[model samples]
Target: MKSVDATEFRVGGSDGWTVTTSFNYNQWAEKNRFQVGDSLLFDYDSGKDSVYQVNKEDYDKCHTEKPIETYKDGHTSIKLDETGTLYFISGNCGNCRKNEKMVVQVMACRGSCNSAASLGYLSCLGVVGAFVASLLL
Candidate 1:
């Protein structure tokens, strides 16, 4: 996640999912599109106090039972496992009205087998290619 300002954050993909701090709920959701096995990181800003909570709809689908709290200038991580939409909000009362909510879209693998087998096959091919190259040398 990237910090845009004292009260803003952003997300980007490094080895995984990434996001940027959004000013509104809809903006956040559009920016950070979540997938299964992905995670969301909230990087809080200093001095500017804030609180974050997931939307009730998201909590129900994921069976996430937790209360919201004030956020610090660091990283808050949330993992996505199921396929659905996740929403979040800053519980900062008046501040919330000033654009302080986040959302994410989580998608699951489509087919039964999906791309797992394909990935494995590609890995095997890579190993074979390396071995053949070594033998030739």
Candidate 2:
């Protein structure tokens, strides 16, 4: 996957994953923007699941790590199903400073199993045809 440094706050992957890290919740939310079909993974040292999202207007009442999926080793996964901007902030005040956010893009597989199977069948047919011609000669 191709990766580009999206400054200290964010990192972008060619596959379609964006990673972001920030100490301040408000700062991170303001800078990063999310879109539909995008996936987000958060990396934290301690507070993996401790993340929250709030609407732009009412930032105060919006505090919960509910939407965010936490990982054991400072990692979180979020899939952006809806086409809208998503905002997040570190719940841990202390760890926030050191936390670095990362974005990972999930790329679709280039070929499906059906395609592979068809190619294999074609190849076997060619071999069989060649063998039969040689025997007849």
Candidate 3:
């Protein structure tokens, strides 16, 4: 097994998660480098706000209903197991209308992340060799 050190992002930064203010989540995400295996920690006031994980279509459309997943414990931790784009929004319609949405891109895992792990990166050389042969033809 490989041990990967993941970063835990606190949604909404020091203010925690909420739509009470004109907080810029997109700005915060732009500064962070997210990768596979990282975790997101959403700390908010459950009584007032809720978290919803939705697909891009739902996120862009601001459809709060039928979320892919829902979290209301206020302190939620989500693991990024794959490299791709993730979309999140406030379950509250008012908040969603206020643009309480966030998107993050998880980067692909780097090779040989741990010193103890052995990688078969060289195994793909056969394909590379085939491509090089085509270039000669």
Candidate 4:
């Protein structure tokens, strides 16, 4: 079972999921760390936009027809059940082409992260883990 202490991220930060070509989802994704218990919240306009979880090939090509998973409710929350890379792109190919895609790398929970008192502590551990990984690399 997933941990109830998981952290939920608002995709694209304050800007949210939209066709704003200026926003860089990839960059935003890189700024944070994802764990197995983490979740992503995609907020957008259901009438005009949608979210699609696709493979790396489809994400790069902006191919929406063969999405691995589709979310069109305007507000989508997807949980990270395991550790690995997950790719997501906009349903609107045009928007996707304009940089509306993100590649998330989820890492396994280390130490006592799940038992942390505050969710913020989990995030702190993630940052520390990244630092440790970078040093090893």
TM-score winner: 4
Model 4 TM-score, all chains together? 0.77
TM-score of each: 0.47, 0.35, 0.76, 0.77
Candidate 3: Cα lDDT at 137: 33
Please give the lDDT score at residue 74 for candidate 4. 93
Question: What does candidate 4's lDDT look like per residue over 61-127, in tens digits?
Answer: 9999999999999999998988899999999988898888899999887444443334444456587
Candidate with best lDDT:
4
Candidate 2: lDDT over CA atoms?
Answer: 0.40
What RMSD, rounded to one decimal, does every model reach? 10.7, 11.8, 7.3, 9.6
As a whole number from 0 to 100, the lDDT of residue 114 in candidate 4 is 42
Candidate rank order under lDDT: 4, 3, 1, 2
Off by over 4 Å in 4: 1-4, 113-137
lDDT of 2 by residue, 1-137 (tens): 12222222232332111224523334444465544334565544453335544343322334333434334444546665544444444454333334322222233323222233444555576877745644553
Candidate 1 wrong stretches, greater than 4 Å: 1-22, 56-73, 109-137
Q: Residue 91 in model 4: shift from native, Å?
A: 0.5
Model 2: lowest-lDDT 10 consecutive positions: 1-10
Per-residue lDDT for 86-119 in model 3, tens only?
8999988788878788998999665535322222
